[model samples]
Target: MAGFVAVIVVVDLAVHFYLWKRLVRDVTRPGWRRTAGTVVAAGLAVLVPVTVGATRGGHLWWLAWPGYVWIGLMFYLLVALVPLEVPRLALVLLWRPTSRTSEAAETLSRRQAIARGAAIVAGLTAAGTTGYGMRTALGPPRLQRVQMPLAKLPRSMDGLRLAIVSDIHLGPLARTHHVGRIVDLINSVTADIVCVVGDLVDGSVAELGKFAEPLRGIESRQGAYFVTGNHEYYSGFAPWIDEVASLGVRPLRNERVEIGGLDLAGVNDLGGAQYGDGPDFAKALGDRDPSRPVVLMAHQPVVARQAAPFGVDLQVSGHTHGGQMAPFNLVVKLQQPVVSGFGRVDGVPVFVTNGAGFWGPPLRVGAPPQVTVMDLRSS
Candidate 1:
């Protein structure tokens, strides 16, 4: 990961230097401000790890300051990556504007072009940030309770209300307030069953403790079920499993449970620590009555393709976060069969929620965080 980041940094610096070189050709003395800014940005990137590590063992107040500072600095870094203004600036510097009218006109054209580029960058940045803010602020707290006919569902689940919330990356960004809102949203629906399809907590068990109480408040009729998301492996799955268990959310690891004439099966994350450790669906589900409905929970949507072969009725998953931001949706499409929302894979219905909380950057633009409320009815 460090190597990957270094590669990105190097490419970005190359672009910056390429622009700088071009500017120097046109402008003799463009001043030291741009040079200083570039140097400062690079220095900050280098210091990011050190700065983050320094927050460890710090006071709560002290910790928050660096966090906020880091957030701003990261945003600045993202802005610096815009190819519009920076590249245009470089072009202008590389080509000097002559006093001749034709040269002046050409210079004006270049200036206009650069101005347009800068405007585009500014617009995109503002729109992206605003969209993120709106999603964080005004996005629906949870899935709306809609009564779907039981006849639309598999034969066994005559009338089952399943509330699914995924990708609750509970770290510094998702504080007590956010968790409380999520709990309130979950409690709002009269779901007979609740499924959390992984990424319940972002960091360590200790980080999750801050919002565990509110998470504990999330309610369901039968029970709230959890599966391991990839984040769990990074955050220490063993301790997180115990912590969530204490909160009344049971972790289902390659196991099956019968509920209201429906079989609830779960497997660990496909790309997690217990990837192949769990009982195979075909094996664990073999004992289940095929005439009855089976709802499986896997952390990733990738498992749906496999579950379909086993005659699962509905498979719920997250782990994608619906790309978290824009254009990344294209990237996510290449990875997951079902990026977000309901889709039929093979013979089974798969529902992938965008997620209830965010991961990094604390931003959800095109994809807002969600609490999925799926009502299953007998077919």
Candidate 2:
């Protein structure tokens, strides 16, 4: 953990330094204005780790608001400014001054103009993107009703709806009301089974437990269920496992349960292997009858490959947040086979949800927060 924190601080400091150079130093001459910008950038840089500490510490929840928002803005600013570097470089290298005196003045004026213009563009772009993402993240999750037609789905189970909710990082940013709203929305749909697919909180149960009280109110025909996500492992999986169960939500925990003649199985997150608590496909699926269609709730889409041999008809996941922040999803794709919606891995069908809450920045770009309703139907 210390090593990871060290890396984050180093990378954050480096990025902030780059942002200051491009948006501050390059745009403003050496003056108090530049000094002030430097101070602001430095403060924001330090806030990254501070906010992380506050969230993990679970004490100063209020700080998470500004800290995370700035983080989001900083990300978009970096994105917008990096590409401007290309054009700025082109101008410096290609432009030729005919006379020294006139050339020097013209060059300086042009540089200032370009720098200021680039700064303005990047600032607006970042603010707009971050603002839009914030609205999308804070608002009620987009309820997605999707059909899952399983070839072996029992005729009695036809038209069964399973509401999939994952990654509700209910800590500093998202509190009780957030969970309440989601519960209200899911209840309205009246799903056959509501699957709270892990990543329920960022802090420990003693800190964020009460915030999740709204979960007990969830209304479903069968019952609400829970499974561990990668975040759960990070937030002390054992206690969270017990806490989730207290909310009247059953934790699948590498186990299987029969519902509507369909086998519903779940495993610990694949990432848990580092803690010697990885997914046990055999325990969760091996004992199952092959003839019955099984729907697996494993937090990550990549696990589909591991569970493929067990014959998972459908795997629901939410780890990627559908690349919550745009080009970021492209990176997510490298790790998880499917970022969002239906995708096949090792010929196993996987449906990755964008999840119902934000993780770090309280903002989402191309991937809007969602609660996908898997409307199971017989193929």
Candidate 3:
């Protein structure tokens, strides 16, 4: 853990230093403006680790707002500024001033003009994107409908709606009201089953269990079910297993249940491997009747490759948060086969939702928080 924190601190320093060089030094005159920018840059660099430590370790939940907001802003600033580097570089290489005093002054003036212009563009882009993302993240989750046709599903089970909710990292940013809002939205759907895929909370049940109480309000017919996500392992999976059960949601731990002729199976998150509790497809899917249409609920979409041999008709998952932020999804795809929406992974049809909550920064871009209704169709 120390090593991991050290790496994060190092990376944080590097990012802030580059940001300072571009957004501060290049944009400001050699005076108090530059000094002030240097101070703010350094302070924000320190705030990164402090915010994470205080929130995760010290449990200073209130600091989550300012801390995470700045994180989001910082991220977009880099995203915006990195692209401007190309133009900035081109200007440096193309503009050559001879050893004339007047020419040197003109060249300097033009350079400053371009630098300041680049700063303004990056600043506005980052601010606007972050603002929109904040609104999308903090506001109520959007309702998304996906029509999925299953080859082995019984015709009688067609039109069965499974409400897909995942990545509801219910800690400091997502509280009772947030869960309550999600519950209300899920209830409005009158889904047959509500699947909480994983990454439910960052903290333990003792600290954040009350925030999840709203889940009791879920109005599903067959029932609400939960499968462990990576975060559950971090937040004491043993207690969370019991907590969700107490709230009337069944925890599917490497097990399957027959529901209206459909086999609904769930497994522990892959992260649980560290705790000797990782997903066991054999335990969950080994003896299941092949004729039954199986809908596996594992946290990460990458599990499809492992589950392919099980003859799973469909898998519903949420771990990528649909990338949570734009361009970030591109990174997510490197790990997850299907970041969001329908895809065929190793012959198994998988549907991934954007999930219903935010994680670290309380901001989502390109992809908004969502409660997806997977309308199952028999083909």
Off by over 4 Å in 2: 94-98
Please state every model's RMSD to the true fold in angstroms. Answer: 4.9, 1.4, 1.5
Clashing pairs in 1: 22-94, 23-93, 23-94, 150-377, 150-378, 151-378
Give candidate 1's whole-model lDDT: 0.69
lDDT of each: 0.69, 0.89, 0.90
**What is the Cα-based lDDT of residue 15 in candidate 1?**
48
For 1-379, candidate 2 gives per-residue lDDT tens digits of: 8999789989998999999888888788889999999999999998998897876736788898999999999999989999988998898778777788799877877787788889999999999999999999999998998988899988888999999999988888889999999998899898999888878888888888888899889899898888898888777889888888888899998999998688889999877899999999999999778889988999888889899998889999888898999979989888888999999999999998899998989999999989988889897
Clashes of each: 6, 0, 0
| lDDT tens readout by residue for model 3, 69-120 | 9999999999999999899879977877776777878787778878888889
Instruction: Output the worst ten-in-a-row residue range by lDDT, candidate 3.
Output: 49-58
Which residue runs does candidate 1 get wrong by more than 4 Å? Answer: 1-29, 47-124, 127-157, 273-279
Rate residue 156 of model 2 by lDDT: 84
Mark the 10 consecutive residues where model 1 has the least summed lDDT. 20-29
Query: What lDDT tens digits, residue by residue, belong to model 1 across residues 276-327?
Result: 4443666656666777667789888877777777787778888888876665
Error of 3 at 221 (Å): 1.2
